[model samples]
Target chain A: MELKNLGEFNFIHSIESDTIYDPNTVVQGIGDDCAVYKVTEGYEQLVSTDTMVEGVHFSFQYMMPYDVGYRLMTANLSDIAAMGGIPRQVVLSVAAPGHIDTRILEEIYRGVKEQCQHYHVNLIGGDTVSIDGPMVWTITIIGEIPQGKAVLRSGAQPGDVVGVTNYIGYAATGLGSLSYNLDGYPMTRIGHQRPEPQIELGITLRELGVHSMNDISDGLSSELNEIAKSSRVSIIIDETLIPLHEETYKLAEALQTNPIDYALLGGEDFQLVFTAPKELSKALENLGSITLIGEVIEGEPVVQSVTKAKEIRLLEAKGYNHFHE
Target chain B: MELKNLGEFNFIHSIESDTIYDPNTVVQGIGDDCAVYKVTEGYEQLVSTDTMVEGVHFSFQYMMPYDVGYRLMTANLSDIAAMGGIPRQVVLSVAAPGHIDTRILEEIYRGVKEQCQHYHVNLIGGDTVSIDGPMVWTITIIGEIPQGKAVLRSGAQPGDVVGVTNYIGYAATGLGSLSYNLDGYPMTRIGHQRPEPQIELGITLRELGVHSMNDISDGLSSELNEIAKSSRVSIIIDETLIPLHEETYKLAEALQTNPIDYALLGGEDFQLVFTAPKELSKALENLGSITLIGEVIEGEPVVQSVTKAKEIRLLEAKGYNHFHE
Candidate 1:
């Protein structure tokens, strides 16, 4: 059935039926003007919003409705992870043409429900509106952390060691493989379609005394540049230490581009990039699959790369430009 | 300058400069992956999100960029007010065509900043993306109320008096005047263009022991119908007691329509419709410009209206349907 025929309230009721129950925090959900929740005492709140517009963020050619909803939730969850917080609730607003089938929206909501159940988050409240244009999804996530426990990008010190949770360039390579319909790159394809938010890894890092952190959403160079600029410290990464999946190299070779470039400039990795004191470097490494790739230095707010040939090269603090694209 | 030339980051930076300072509660704002805030120890958090799509909610023909931003914020704030909550922070996501001028966005942000400062709410983090279609603005508001003190629509008991803040029908008449370029309805035009959310009135009502409450964003009949359904009570409104502005009557006559119909089915009034016990009716009257227009009864969930001649008429729960519109 089309949305116009189903009407707005019935369509909303259908989606609300599958909301994850969270009685401990959510006082009211879905039906009220505002969703009320009890804030855990002695904890701070964290909020972040992200928007995905059709034709700009994704195309129907490469992504199904389920993928779009799942990825949007993943992106918002990654923001909470970057803050060392546990996500608790989300409000999603969607705008789509009236001619669309109701089942498509139901599938999207099902994807959202799957992610919320996986993360133990509650779907609190949101708005659904009709548009005359392409579909647009905007999600706002609310999370909580212990008071004064949030690790900000401004906390890194001059001599801190920079580390990342996983290999980079996989998501970018996944996009490339999907775009060209290349075979034999399941890891990259899954990476782009369903990137995982490092929520547990972030909390562990915070407990491990990581000074500063960010999620790698805008590629390695741009993420590093943000850390450096916010903390007012110079950062230099060793080219040999940067981890890239083997599939990334193959895809870059097929596309006639450098794998390092993809690792540096491609985005949507959703891995945690953080800094810790040198004394905690061994502890960080022992905790998980984290790689120490760089060091903070006392200088201007710039990011540099030490090439394999032992020469330092300046890296431009540029990433995916949405408007330009 | 077009947004394409300014790029996403710089456009964000331009708006970041106008954020209101809230050092007491906000630990971090705008720059990080997530905005961080300290929650009050004895309060519950309230969250609500609303979206406005270009050509669906508003058009440049009827609204300036400033009005669009201001109205969107008003809509989100009204949701919090309906729950007797104090709005504190907001996250706004905007998706627009790349060819739109940067000054227009700046003006919109300026209007947003004006409202934030007026309400003492801080601007938190959000996303800005380029869309190939119409402009869409989605705002999420985070608010707070004393623990277990929020007023829900399901709390109204039989024999409670239903009341409303100020006169209705003005907004619907205002829309008509604006659309037809009719003069002599300046009040209606301003009412439609810059509707105010009754935040203070809501808090006062909650303090005065009001049972149920809702903001009249979808006309009086629709709002009353929701309350009746949620509370499982019948509501009977007195047509003689329903307040209508003189300007509304004049405009309705000019358009050959009944002003009562406008009051019943026209939306975007942003007025408060609530219920209070009979003993508290005097207290509600003393509080401000509140009018008691109806009474709740133990019956099927339906709304009826009583004419001056003692004739009863069933009222349809019809209001603004986003998809149908």
Candidate 2:
């Protein structure tokens, strides 16, 4: 049945669950004006919000309702991960068209609930409104970190080594594969639909004394430029050092597309990127899948790409921006 | 110019402010992956979110950009006040069509910033996205209250006295005035456009030992019905005791409509309704502007209304549901 027929209160009751993970910390959940919970002493709180709108951020042409919810949560949680914090609570605001199916909302909530449960984050309180526009979901996450331990975008410094977790360009290729109905490359397609937040990697990087950090949400270019601008330092990344998933390389070859473009321009890669002192390079390498991709240098805060063939060119720090065509 | 021409990062930079209320607690604010702040010890945190859509929750015809932002914040803050908590920080997620004028967005932010500044609430972090749909804004608020002291909707008990602050029905009449371009009722129009969050009054009511409380954002009918259902108690409200502003009565008389219908069905009042022990009525009344409206009784959880003519009728326990229509 459509949501308009179900009614707001009925839809909420239909999807509400007894899903509190920790009763001691959560005094109340789901059914209240505001969720009241205990705050741990000596900890700093981290808060961030992310929004996804139908036909703008994602569409059913590329993702299911479950995938939409899953990816939206991942995008929001990645911000917490980027800050080297552990997510504890979340509140959601969902606005869907009244003509939308109630089951779609249920599936969306299921994805949200399962992901939050996996991370031990409480789904505390939310607002659900019926709208006449495309469906949108906004998640505000609360996380906690040890006081004075949050990695900042401005913490990168000259002589620091820049690194990333896992291969880039996978999600972009995944989007391409799905859009064009390309065969094979199941991993690349999954990457586009189910980007995973690198929470544990963030904690590890913090422990390794990483100076600065960000999640590659709007592609590597935006992340690198933001760090450079915030830290007032320049970054030079080696094109050869940038890793691409095997599926991404294969799909790029089949489509005759430069894989590097995907890594630079395609977003939705919820992977961790950080800069640390050069001396920790050996230790970082010991940790599997950590790629030393670039160096922070003393210059104007701009990003330049250098090829192994000794050619160098300035790379635009622009990425997939919603307001920029 | 439209937001598409201005671009997302440029728009963000234009609106970015260095407004930090307390540096000691706020380690980081805007321009970070997540806002970081020190958590207060021995206190419980309160969190809630609210959403407003351009055509569903409001319209530009009845409100300017400033009023939209102002009323949106008030609606969210009222939830925090309903829990007897002091609002501390807020994060916003705004999605607007790329065709929208950037100046409208600037005006909206100005209103939000001014209102937040007045309440000492920090606008720490938010997401701004371009969509192909109507403008939508979601605000997630973080508040804190003394441990175990927050009022809940389920705290009302049998024999508790129900009371409301100030008056109700002004906003509906105000909406009516704006809709028909009626003259001679400026207060009602302002009331509809600018409902204030009763934070101080909430604290006072909590100290005066209010059992259960709600903010009348969805009118008295919804508030009373929710309280009754949550507390598993019956409520009987007297028609004569339902307070109405003098302006509301005049507008209703001019329009030839029942003022009580406005109080019962028209929402956006942002007034507080609470229940207290019978002995506290004198204290509550002495506080000024508090009206005794109803009494909780032992019966099936239903809401009923009695007229001054001594006739009783079952009041439908529903109000202002977005999907119900």
Candidate 3:
């Protein structure tokens, strides 16, 4: 099962199985040097790259190979969701130490295939290499949006209400519980390990003409700061208005840390956050359990949260820093 | 300064400087969640990925950071060239240890920027991460080709002629000379380090009705075998007719090996190899320095090289194997 014994052609042919979800869009898939694809007429293109380095992004002690591949794909897919684009294809580049088992890679790739099938994206051609280091996975994704319909973060305007789907902070809370894991909260653990991209909500929100959108991966504060700076506007949110799952609250109590801190600083929650006209609040609620927690204001790009006593505090970005962390 | 000393936002901003080349095509580039762009109206899309791991693909002793980036871009661009496409955009994902100097990364990005400018490609958004392992760079390239005009490796007919562009053995010959650290073959060193993609030749060959095409990254024998297997034909090449640079021949003689061995077995040439109608030989001759070294025949997919001493030998794929190597 070791990759060293698996010859090159066999190793390549192994992963080329059952990967493509839509044959119509792919002219050539895995066997070619480049995967030739056709974009639907009248659609603009969306491209993004996501990389996960072992021990930096995820730990094997906490996540299986399947979780790694699934989370990696979700991370990139969420970017397309933020753009209100339809993810169509992804090409992966994977490097692992030669001593690793090929079966572990097969499990990782299985996770990728199943997730791509869930999102209806094609697993196109990719490059695989051997390295003398920890395993690395990088996926370059391609998505499509109707011409000129991309909802950029810079489109947030004053009087827009910021809304978020589902709950946040559960992922971070779940991560904190991993060290003393005793099968306490499975839901929060799933929140961290297997979060799904909000592709359906993205498409519907684009149709609903949301002013701007962002995916919550690097915590609520970082996402809010990005939207504010890009739109050149200020935002105000009530700290108590931020939604947290019941499990998140219970887990945070067990860990002896405030759940709000997880909501503001911890990440890997694939929920979506968006700014839309305040008048469309009812319409957004009709689509799902959206929580309108903040308001955009006319000022410099700064995000502030109001406490219960109406005290304002600056919400600075403390997202995951690649080099420093 | 080490990347650890440099903060995250500053590190990202450093590479985002002057990275865009074609502003018209890029609706949004580096500062967004995903890069948004427009494909030319009548062209289909080409997607491919290439990866380079430190100590696996290249070494710091043999190549500087600039050379690494330049050569990495060239490798992916060559895939586009092989498909007879015009490369338009690229997204890179790079991971390095925190102790690596930030200036070294700047040099790498500068090299990527310069190469993108050379090819008129937009240096779009990418993900940069930190790892506790060897440096890795993954580039996902996008290209465009006129609809139904791409030359696949499966199009060669029975009577087609196998041709190669430029010299074939110099890169492999140069790589072999790297171990001695001698000034004996600087040309070969450059060949291994800075090989350019044959985009113009590929485009012209496609327009001139080349039936099949492949870039010579995996040696002449492996590329020809790929074409034969894809096209379901047998190929016979005269090893004597294989072209080599004067320096390549001299280096081979000095190293006490046949230049044809390198042409048949060694890789990383980045040259163009194609099959065209035998009657188009005169037309192909006008395209400068194309060597017609072989012929396609109606048989099973096998590659045989005829020696000058009137002996036929099977040319197996002894190219670089990711796992076994």
TM-score of each: 0.98, 0.98, 0.98
Quick one: ranking by DockQ, best first?
2, 1, 3
Cα misplacement distance, residue B233 of candidate 2 (Å): 1.1
For model 2 chain B, the run of ten residues with the poorest summed lDDT: B16-25
The runs of at least 3 residues in candidate 2 whose Cα sits more than 4 Å from the true structure, single-residue gaps closed, are B18-24
Per-prediction DockQ: 0.86, 0.86, 0.82
Q: Native-contact fraction for each model?
A: 0.91, 0.90, 0.85
lDDT by residue (A1-325, candidate 1, tens digit) is 9998888988898888767556699888989899999878889999999999888887778778787788889999999999889999999999989999998888777777788989999999989999989889999999999999999999989889999988888898988898898998999888888888999998898888899999999999999999999999999999788889999889878989878887888899999999899999889889768999999999999999998889999987787888875
- In candidate 2, the residue pairs with backbone N, CA or C atoms under 3 Å apart (3 or more residues apart, or in different chains) clash, namely none
How many Å off is the CA of B178 in candidate 1?
A: 1.3
Q: Residues A1-325, candidate 3, lDDT per residue (tens digit)?
A: 7887886578888888888898889888887778899999999999999999888887789888898889889998999999899999999988988888888888888888888999889999898899898989999899999999999989999999999888888788778778677467888888888888988888899899999999999999999999999999999998898889888788778778777888889898988889999999999989866888999999999999997678999999777888885
**Residues B1-325 of candidate 1: C-alpha lDDT, one tens digit per residue:** 9999999989999899768556688989999999999878788999999999988888878778888788888888899889888989999999989999999888777777777887888998889998989889999999999899999999889999999999887788888888888899888888887788888898999888899999999999999999999999999999888889998889878989877887899898898899989999888888768999999999999999998789999887896888874
Best by DockQ: 2
CA lDDT of each prediction against the hidden true structure = 0.89, 0.88, 0.88
